[model samples]
Target: YLFSQRAAWKPALTLNGFLSASKRFVEKDLEVCVAGRTFMITGANSGIGKATAIAIAKRGGIVHMVCRNKDKAEEARADIVKETGNKEIYVHILDLSETKKVWEFAESFKRKYKSLNVLINNAGSIMSQRDVNTEGLEKSFATNVLGVYILTKSLIPLLEKSPDPRVITVSSGGMLVQKLRTGNLQSERGRYDGTMVFAQHKRQQVVMTEQLAKAHTNIHFSVMQPGWVDTPAVANAMPDFHRSMKDSLRTPEQGADTVVWLAISEAATTNPSGRFYQDRKMVSTHLPLAWTHSSALEEQKLMSLLEDLAKTFQPH
Candidate 1:
C-alpha cells in the first residue's frame, strides 16, 4: 500500500521535469495590479529571488529588497526601479543565517510598512562543509529553515493587516528524496553530508508551510520548488551539475514564474493553502522512495522544534 501511494507521484515528477525544460508553464497572463501592495523578498540581489522581485515591481507593487550586501541590493533595486518605472523599491540589509538579524529586519519592516501583501522567503545556501553561525546552528538549516520561520512568524501580524496576504517560500525539487529526521533536526547525530542537509532543510520548509497554513488559516501559505534553474548560485554551488545541464536548465525568470503568479494571480489565491507547487500547479511532496514518506507525528514534532527555536530569538 505504501509503495502504491508513493508510486503514484512518479508520473508527476516526470511531467514536472518535462514542463520545466520546455518552459511551457510560465504564467504569461498575469494582469493583476498591485499598485500599493507591499512585497518583501529575501536574497533579492540575484538569481530567482531577484527575478521575482523585478516581476513584482513591474506590476506597480511596493517591493522591499532584503539582502545581505547593501551595494548589491542597491544596484538590484535601482535596476528594478529603472526597468519597472516604479520607485517604491526599498532595500534592507540582512544576513538571514543570523537569527538576530532576521528578527531585527522583520521588526524594522513592520515599523515602516502598515500592510504586507506578500512575503517571499527566497534566500538559501548550500554549504560544501558543515559550518555554524553565531547562533550555533548549522548554516544551511539556519538560513533556509529557521530564518524563514523567524521572519514569517514575526511578520504574521503585518500580513494579517492586508486584505489578501500570501507567503510564498521557495523550496526545491531536491526535497523529494528527503524525509523529516525528527531526532536529528540539526543533523548532529550522524555524519553530515552537505547536499543531504540542504535537502533536509528544503523538506523542513515544505513541512513548515503545511503547519503555518493550518495555524493561520486566513493567510495563504504556499511553498514551491523552482525546479533546476540556471542561476549563478547553481553554477558556483554545483559546478559539475551546472556544466552537464547547462543547455537544459531553465532561466531565472522561468524559475520565478510560479512565485510571481502566486503573489498576484487571483487564480492562485483561490487554490487551497499549504500546497507544494511547481510549474504553477500543485505537485506531490514525496516520491516513491521508502524513506520519503513522513508521518504526521514527525511533521508535528518538526513544527514544535521550529516554533521553540523561533521563540528563543523573538525580539523583546
Candidate 2:
C-alpha cells in the first residue's frame, strides 16, 4: 500500500520533483566544450537516452548512439544533427537482449574507435508479460541486468585507458522497493510479476555498479535514477501509471539532467564511485527502514554469477 500511495512516491518522481531539484543545479557545470571526447549512449533512439545524447552532442562531444532499430536511431540522429549542428553523431544497431551480439558490438567498437571517454548505459526494458529469450534468460533480465553487466564489463579496459573515463547507468528510484535476490536473478521462479522483476533487475544494476567500482579504480561507476518522465516506454509498459501521472511526469530532458551532470560535471566524479544519485545529489540506494539491504554474500553472488555468464558469451 505504501508503494501505491500518491503521497509516498509521486512527490519524489514527478515534475515538481524535477523543478525543485533544478533550482540547485549549477549552470556552469555543463559549460565546458567536449570537442574531442567520445560518449556512447545505449537506447539512444528516444526518451532519456536521446536527451542525454543531445546534451553531449551540443557540447561538441563525439556521440555514438546505440539502439536496437536502425530506422528510429537514424531518425533520432537526423534530429540531433539538425539541433546541435555537431555532425559527429553516429548510430549503431544492436539489441540488448541478444547478449552475444552485445559482446560482438563492444569488441568491434573497441577496434573501430581509439577511446571511449564515457559510456552511458541508458537502455532498459520492462515487459508486461514474462518472456525468456532463446538463451533461456528472462527478457527483462537479459536486457536490463545481463546486457548492462556484459556491456560495462566488456568496455572496462577501453574505458580505463581513456581520460576522465566514467560509466553512468540510468537506473530508477523503483529499485528501492527490491532487495538483491541473486538466487533467481533471471526470474525463472514462481508467479512472474513484471514490475517486481524489473525492480529487481534495477536493483541488480545498483549492486553491479558498486561491485564494478571496487574492482576497477581507474573508472568511475555511477547509477542514477532519472525522475519519472513522459516517455513512450513508460506509456507502453505501464499505461495506467502513465495515464494517471501524465500531468505530473517530467520531460525527457528534465529526467536526463542528472545523467548529463554526472557524465560531464566535475562535481560528480569528486564524490566516491559506486554511490547512487538522484537530482544530481548522491542518494542512498536503499530507502531508510525499507529492510531492503542484501547481505554482502548475496551481493558477491550477483557479481560472480554475472561474471561467469559474461565469460561464457564473450568473444574469444
Per-residue lDDT of model 1, residues 1-316, tens digit only: 6658646644333434646444654345488788999999999989999999988888889998889899999998888888889999988899999998888988888897798989999999898888899889888888999999999999999999898999999998878878777787777777878778888899999999999999999999999988778888889989998898787777788789888988889888888999999878887787644567788898999988988988887778
Flag regions of model 1 displaced more than 4 Å: 1-29
lDDT of 2 by residue, 1-316 (tens): 5455425655988999889888988999888788899999999989999999999999999999999999999999999999999999999999999888889999999898989999999999998888888777788988999999998988888998899999999998889888899888777778888988988989999999999999999899999999799999999999999998899999999999999999999888999998899999998887756778999899999999998988887778
User: Worst 10-residue stretch by lDDT in candidate 1?
Assistant: 9-18
The per-residue C-alpha lDDT of model 2 at residue 126 equals 91
lDDT comparing candidate 1 with the true structure: 0.86
CA error at residue 232 for candidate 2, angstroms = 0.6
The best candidate by TM-score is 2
